[model samples]
Target: MEAYNFETAIKPFFWVASDKTFSVCLNAGTYKPEIFEWRKDEGFEGNGYDWASLAKVFLEEKRPDLAEDIRFDPEADMFCAYSENPDKLKEFITGFKETCENELQIQDLFLKAEID
Candidate 1:
């Protein structure tokens, strides 16, 4: 058996860049269901609930100073931002990674953390 790491696991997924750029990669998982699905039990339900909308929420929740710069790309099935910020990008990836790790079962998960 072989061990896996974050990059390898996420390599197959696409990333929503801040410049409204859609990175062609692998989609590990949406991690955020509420952003796509607007239902009470399903997840977050409010005025705005898509990726761009959620980005606003995340920005406000995290960076109040930074204005929300987000866009929705149906073709890519992801939300992107107009501003290019490393911290925001890292935060987004971290959130997605953490969610995938917590929600997905080890055996069910495609990406596994390296043992060593």
Candidate 2:
């Protein structure tokens, strides 16, 4: 069996959107995007999972105050980032975190089952 690196496995989809600049860098983790100046500087952290899901996670993590209105279009690159209710967004963020942790646990369970 071949072992895959965690960071290397999910490096194909990571990007960043700044106020004045928008950039998309493919597999930013495996390849250096800093030299290209695609807004993926050294400080840019690659999404730890698949693209869209990671984007959502990143947004929620960075701004736990606005998670509800952060609807990412599956067919679009931009997120529908807006919300009139901060309280709802806060709730969504908390739920999203719990969902992520649950997913991690599930994955771990599956891996352990396979190993056993």
Candidate 3:
């Protein structure tokens, strides 16, 4: 599989811009076998995986804390970005939903998923 670019990150993921604000969970493993199968078939690190860098950059803009590349973490488990700050994550997800339309196109398979 091609390395995920911002434009290609939309597939295999549905922004959980959701209530995980106890902490931000940018991506998580999926249990669905089909997804898992696809992930394995594609050599993905995990299901629901997203290209983490774009997410980090988006969050980096709003975050004021020390940052490191998740890739450097041997223990890194997230498929995208993660944050201890709920508000920052919300801002990131909301920003992606509210913006990025012109910058990306959800994989046609995800076209029906809400962008807003």
Between which residue pairs do clashes occur in model 2?
Answer: none
What CA RMSD would candidate 1 show?
10.7
Per-prediction TM-score to the true structure, in the order listed: 0.38, 0.27, 0.32
Write down the lDDT that model 2 would get: 0.37
Best by TM-score: 1
For residue 115, give model 3's deviation from the true position in Å. Answer: 25
For residues 1-116, what per-residue lDDT tens digits would candidate 1 score against the true structure? 88855455544344444353433223212544432332334442322223344444444544445544333232244333433554555445445445445544312322222111
Model 1 stretches with alpha carbons more than 4 Å out: 1-13, 16-49, 65-76, 96-116
Instruction: Please write out the lDDT profile of model 2 over residues 6-83, one tens digit for every residue.
Output: 334323333345664333334323432222233234322333223344445445445555555554433222222223
Candidate 1's TM-score: 0.38
Q: Could you tell me which 10 consecutive residues in candidate 3 have the lowest summed lDDT?
A: 107-116
RMSD of each: 10.7, 15.0, 12.5
Candidate 3, number of clashes:
0
Residue 78, model 1: lDDT of 37
What lDDT does candidate 2 reach at residue 73?
39
